[model samples]
Target: MNYKRLLFCLFTGFTVATSPAFAFQELQPSDDYIQVSKEIVEILEGTHYNKPSINDQISELAFEDYLDALDPTKSFFLQNDINALSVYKKRFDDAIKSGDTQVAYTIYNLYLKRVEERLTDLENNLSAMLEGFDYTLDESLDLDSEHYTWAKNKQEQDETWRKRLKNRALTLKLNGETPEAISEVLTSRFKNQLKRIHQTDAVDVYQIFVNSITAALDPHSSYFAPRASETFNINMSLSLEGIGAVLQMEDDYTKVVRLIPGGPASAKGELSPNDKIVGVAQEGKEMINVVGMRLDDVVDMIRGERGTTVTLEIIPSKGTGQTSKRIKIVREKVKLEDQSAKKEIVEVTRGDDTYKVGVIELPTFYSDFAAQQAGDKNYKSSTKDTKKLIEELRKEGIVALILDLRNNGGGSLQEANSLTGLFIPSGPTVQIQDQNGRITPLGDRDPKIAYSGPLAVLTNRMSASASEIVAGALQDYGRALILGGQTFGKGTVQALQEVDKGQLKITQAKFYRVSGETTQHKGVVPDIIFPSVFDTEKVGESSLDRPLPWDKIHETRYPIYWDMPSLFPILEPRHQARMAKDPDFIALNDQIAEFRENEDKYKTLSLNENTRIQINEETEKRELDRENARRAALGLEAIESVDDIEPTDKLVYSKEAAEILLDFIAINQLAEREKAQQEQAN
Candidate 1:
């Protein structure tokens, strides 16, 4: 597993990337809140519905995802209860349709009342229990096998995490590092972590209880206390006045999952991913121990005035038993641009001809929903910018297009559909199903097909949602051949419905191909499945906390004009043959395997100079292998020896998979030939 996959497999204490545990068992929801939230849901389902407005639906879906995040076994209430209680959903829909929560407050009040009741119940029930209950149950669930492996609750999650750190700390301590140096890193985090539990255990319990009731309704609706619900909105595009980084609660430490590189924390150059912070302080002040404080409270301190400096004392998590040290940095504002798509070109040569293939690396399918809603033509999205890029590439006479969507966590549905339309004739793009089991067809609005020649989609275990839509549609219509690992299996569509004070992000429907097969759990199987360096078990929906199961529907009849067979037969063999001689590909596989073997070696590291020298030597050797592999792949000459290295300030190679440019060039030759034949006949 690469860093991304390892980061996922181990979660924060096995957090699985950007989220804390979603499913916690033994929840006792506020019955009254459930009753009211249910009533509101019913109202939104009926007369209050207006095609599920964006902001409203976002609020709802966000709330829903949070609710689902609470159930440990992903079994909140009994299945029978869900079936029987679904009757009130339409009432909630009606209330939503009544326009604005103020007017619809009647239905909102119902949901609110239930939430309030649940809160009262939690206050009463938890008072009796005191320490809170462990919610994870050992039930067999095949939905997401990974969930079963997650550490349950804060206690389980934190204790296991603390031990891991403690073990690493002991390793460092034994290495002869001063106790004060090690203390500078782990001791504060440990104490702060404990203090957090002592203070906010009740908050987590309340979150669990409320989420339980909301999750039972559907994975979308829930009650939010003022702070948490606010945080949820920020997670789902809540324009909050703070640094833009998604922090996950790990035992007692909050781990930085997705860092907006241009944002305050990332830009501060003080904090980096996998770097654990033990002490945080404002400028000119003494560093404070925040170890045992609740994540939210820590967050409150971390997030503050724009341009104001807050120092974060951190230890980089390069590997385990690596000496944990301290460094401090300031915070600033992080915007979406820090995580958007970038464009470049890859040169491929087959036989005597060279083809310049334009590659668009979309890290994520992000859109300025706020700007678009306000009718801002200046709003940013993948469709608009990529269109501009295509025109530029066309001017350069590029032979083909490679859309790279690996590791994209998906974004706006509207933009994803629009993006697909850029490649195909305007038509229905994806189909969605609601809670009522009614299917709604979403389509491409534009009629123009952008570039129609040879196109290839690059994906992996991380490409998801909107990215999946583009790849799946292209595959279904024969517009493009998908290459690399399987795309992320997030075919479910979520809508956030805004409530009075919070929102519910609910899994309103599942997506279907032009052929009506949903990519939910199965993801998009590539036309060419590469021997991915990725450990499939370690990423995508499989790695999520409470992801839904894979399902399918009757097929749709949308047809394509391209022949998939001609390309596949030749393309597959050519790719396989290329990899055989590809030294870079070979080295990558070896590197991945070796890392897996030594994944736990960090614990054995001693701070002794000899041990440190050995580790650094190994790191350098691995880097040398990687650099040599990259040098060979890019048509560059190989190093004469391991020591004959190209000097660089940093690691030159990125973890992204190299596109099969050779296969694409070969495929294009076939396509160009077909086009010529049609012209001659005409």
Candidate 2:
């Protein structure tokens, strides 16, 4: 199961559904699911800022489009299936709109068997339109012109894909192998492991083809057989136990991109970003070969409950192109608390007096709904925890506080408002408008202003949504000096409604600042811009094949920087002078150069007998060097190794860079403090 070939089939497009080994009934529908889902929808629809007509249109159309794409015969309804589908749609919509995903879950399975029947007949009865073999555009779809080219490419890719899938299906039947057994073989084959093992690579290829074809339809619409669908449900609920790593299909071998801090993977100490998973088995059981298996099937074999041990045969990203090493890991639920506000005391000495700057790292404004809904007073909320941390920082006699919002992808809106209230004197946090041209402002009436001391808000390209709200509010009211790279331009506010609850998350509206500015394409420009490593200026929706336009409204005035003298311009030159000689910044440029040179590093894997197995053991060293150089050039400390630089899997973007970039804000903090102190004396 060559992962590269699997990747090819996936990108090319191939798909199907199969019955599961075990027919597990879904969990009973719960009212709580409905409450949570509808609440989310309501909050989104009640945009307190601008006319979110565009968001509304996209969500509604996407929902219909996704459903139609999934089962055109049912959603579009032929004469025979029309009446039945119409009734089902009514009931389905009723279930979906009720805000109870649990109810929709039941409806989904009710239709699952029906879907299976259609899939079985697809090979025999599908017309050219259904086959999608014809390259002609579906005039009825009236698709974008660019997508026409995408379709042409898809058709070409699909042709190659069908051959692979057909070959796999025929091979599987001739061999008389079970799907799960085939799955294990496929998984194992991905990492090149089917020799002594009792399986072939065809199994893994089938699953990848099925998934890729389904995914080509939309971001959320996955083509999962019953087993994979079951796996999907577990993920949507956000409650799973394993070495909590977000896996990615990098070419063929599934790679670990992020480790969930509280999970076994993070605790294991051996795992890191870019490590590839090759095989899995239960402790005491013969390790199952899983190298090139389909992601869902492989995941099914690995994931288990808490305290349970699962063995992972990992082929690490670097080090001795070794044989798949088996490592046993215990699984655990992801504790949101582990990802809560963390405080670090940054020691800074400008002269004789050293400043203990309390740096608060906020990953996101997260709030655990299930725990909070249960009347847990100590429930996790960013504002509440941050407010608590501010008091603690004050207790330590901190000279300044840095609110680290880099890579914070935002969380609870209420928390964002509450966080804003800590700075702004209980005014509106942001405004939202609906399609009907109605404006609604989300006001913060709480009079609790938390830390009013000298503050510097650190931001970067990944600081988005609630991060923007907090940063924007603080910047408006002269409370904190903003620093770091530009904020991530994610001004659009999304409301996850019951569209299918966990089936699909929908974007319902765009939020706007009180001044009527929607943080859409344009991110918040910090008072002073530092040279950030992630220059995603060209990587946003604005750069998409077809995306919305960037527009603005009347500017809302806040109480911050407006009245402050030219602090940004003044500090810019001084910081520039220092950055010019910074060793760390120079090192960063070196790393970037090396990275550019060997980016084709993966591309050059020689399948030639001797060259392939001798993959370099020096990759970790090289990677560490690259990171060290880049960080150094940025005026940061030279990282001794990758151990010195933690890959911020939890942060929204590259916030690890933001953590080190915190030093650059020292100038901004000083300027603000001096101004405030001089004003007090005057």
Candidate 3:
């Protein structure tokens, strides 16, 4: 039988039954939901970059994705219940395509019932479970839900919940909460979750279901319900006030996607991409657990008036997610000027000579398009600002320049093209390939160069999109030495398309460099690698599910300014030797190595209270020792504890970049002199 036709037959005349008595509410799909689902499918099929076929394979993938979205931790829905719903697994494709979402509602209703039953059991037996926990016993709870199968029965699920509750209690106890305080916090958290359950509506269910299907296509693509669309619009209009971090639901946690450049979180330099926000608290209020809360509700709790404070308890992505840290940020309107490119000059001593290097830190590739379109000559743009800064640096007699693009989560594409033009004399900067297979090369048509002296482009894992374009173009043209870690690899282009009710953000194009290398999953590799504070597995586009693959196309014709490849042999060995001796770099490498070692151990948490405490202490001790070691090497006073160490305000990365620039200038100048001597001899 044809997969599509079979799916059609399966959903034809299929109606969802009313939710069980224990459910929070009798949730059902609305009339507009059907229209919206159909519209989403049509848009995805006709316009999406992949142009995937609607079939049983897609149906199965979407069904699994939906189940994971509903109960990522596998805490609800027994194996028997899953077996009962397995009949509709291959029918989602037709149901979504034909505007029949009864199957989706059916699954969601069952999930709600399972949730109520689990929460009810946990609430009724909370005291008994707490009292029964034996902290000395050698027991543990596997937090990685993928390793779990659905519980065979209610009894099995109860045992799982018992271990979970025990682990939660142990974590709280280790954090200095007394038994009484722990009980109160747990009770309040459970009650809040129960209240939120009752508030679930049809739109929320529809949004999740449709998004699950879209996620099967690509991680960046998603469906936004009407309410969500409104919020998205408000944020885009720059009218919403908050910490300025973009967040998304990752399993049962709200993971930070990217910190908006110049936002409170970005400016504070504490919160970053891939950090899981597990708890939220208002100013002077007790922390509220948000581990399993809806993304919308969490956002509401985090949102507040400007000048207010919101505290977030986050599991840092750089470390194993076994421990968490709190970060407090004051809410503010993210001003456009705050994200603009700025310039500074760093003086580095190399043996007997001191070299002056100009540094430009671009938080984002931004342009005042509204002002520019209205014929405002003084309109703010990254390229214009950078050009002016370059002229000023040249006037000051700087010998080298470094463009710092770390944590620059991209903005205007045109600005990226124009910025790349600053270093090269007219060349193709980037290439765009649309879904229809048309390749468009975007470049700097102007034959003028701003500053063509020794240059380096510094990037990190957070640098993405427009940042990748600029870095990749300059590297391809041999115009600059690319430094730092691999970029964030967000090369796919997304656009918001209007549906019947809300909107669909779909991936429609891909970005490529002049050398024909696509920047989709394999972002631009730096000429010299730096020790990254970010874990690549936890960050970047490759870390996402169903990400587009990296490929290559025909390379565009472009001119190379300097032969960077020939100089790498001379520069790389020096960089490696210097980094090997630098105490700060040594400490960073050791810290990252320790983080990798503990990654496996943190996958499963110890239910034994004593063991958990020991593990946490070991982590803290290692961190303190590393910090002290680095301080001692730098001739600074060692701190007694990690808490006593203040956040260093120094620009270590910029300083290292300046040193690298000095090496490049000396090497290139010596080569030029030797070439002139050879010509004279000839």
TM agreement with the true structure for every prediction: 0.66, 0.58, 0.95
Best by lDDT: 3
Task: Judging by TM-score, tell me the better candidate of 1 and 2.
Answer: 1
Candidate 2 lDDT, 64-107, residue by residue in tens: 44334333323112233323233333332333345433323332
Candidate lDDT scores, in order, read: 0.57, 0.53, 0.85
Clashing pairs in 3: none
Clashes of each: 85, 44, 0
- Summing lDDT over every window of 10 consecutive residues in candidate 2, give the lowest-scoring window: 135-144
Model 2 clash number: 44
Clashes in predicted model 1 = 85
lDDT order, best first, reads 3, 1, 2
Question: Which portions of model 2 show Cα errors greater than 4 Å?
Answer: 1-238, 245-299, 309-330, 368-379, 460-462, 485-488, 495-504, 525-549, 561-565, 576-586, 600-682
lDDT of 1 at 285: 76
Q: Where is model 3 more than 4 Å wrong at Cα?
A: 1-20, 319-323, 646-650
* Candidate 3, 258-314: lDDT as tens digits: 888889998887886778998999999999999889999999998899999999998
